[model samples]
Target: MPDRITLTGLRVFGRHGVFEHEKRDGQEFVVDIVAWLDLAPAAASDDLTQTLHYGELAQLAADIVGGEPYDLIESVAGRIADEVLKDSRLSAVEVTVHKPSAPIPLNFADVAVTVHRGRA
Candidate 1:
């Protein structure tokens, strides 16, 4: 729980937005994930089976963002958090969904939603 594996700036294109134009045209979404788990086992055993594979994690996040259409980035974040937490090895997960091309009709660097979920 004290140690974590983090993946940042994983970008993918998705058609997720409120407006029709936004959904049809699609936009870029960036995701950052922090998975909290005991690293000692993996380190001592020197086996991938003892830890979560980041490549698989990234693919799962990409598939969720690219496959589904959600009106709120909150929902997207929630989904990512939920999926990542499926692994029993993970004690908790933090997911951030970034929306750079949001339809705000104003100047802004980026918009994002972050969610944290832990096992019950």
Candidate 2:
């Protein structure tokens, strides 16, 4: 298995949901991401250039979650996966988008969508 860098519990406000109120009043979304890539180069040289900068990754996810409104969490997950895969060093990525304030009538803890993508 390739080495992985994980970022978890990234919270951002987004206007994403199927309801009109959800769009008008934004809510918090939590995102988690795992990027798989070769870490040997960075380990050997101790250079930041050889590996994925997780800070940038977090920012990228925050931008997507905060930028646009998607009715489905699946689309959000897919978009995040697509953007993270833009890094050539990453062979694969797994993204999970959490919606804690979904419009479910019943009491629920959270709702989330997870997507896994690999270079084609």
TM-score, per-candidate, Cα-based:
0.97, 0.97
Highest lDDT model number: 2
Off by over 4 Å in 2: none
- Give the Å error, residue 61, model 2: 0.3
Off by over 4 Å in 1: none
lDDT scores of the candidates, listed in order: 0.93, 0.96
User: Would you list the clashing residue pairs of candidate 1?
Assistant: none
Model 1 CA lDDT for position 93: 98
Winning candidate number (TM-score): 2
State the lDDT of candidate 1 residue by residue for 55-118, as single tens digits. 9999999999998799888999999999899899899999999999898989999999999999
Kindly list the per-residue Cα lDDT of model 2 for residues 27-116, writing each as its tens digit.
Answer: 999999999999999999999999999999999999999989998889999999999999999999999999998988999999999999
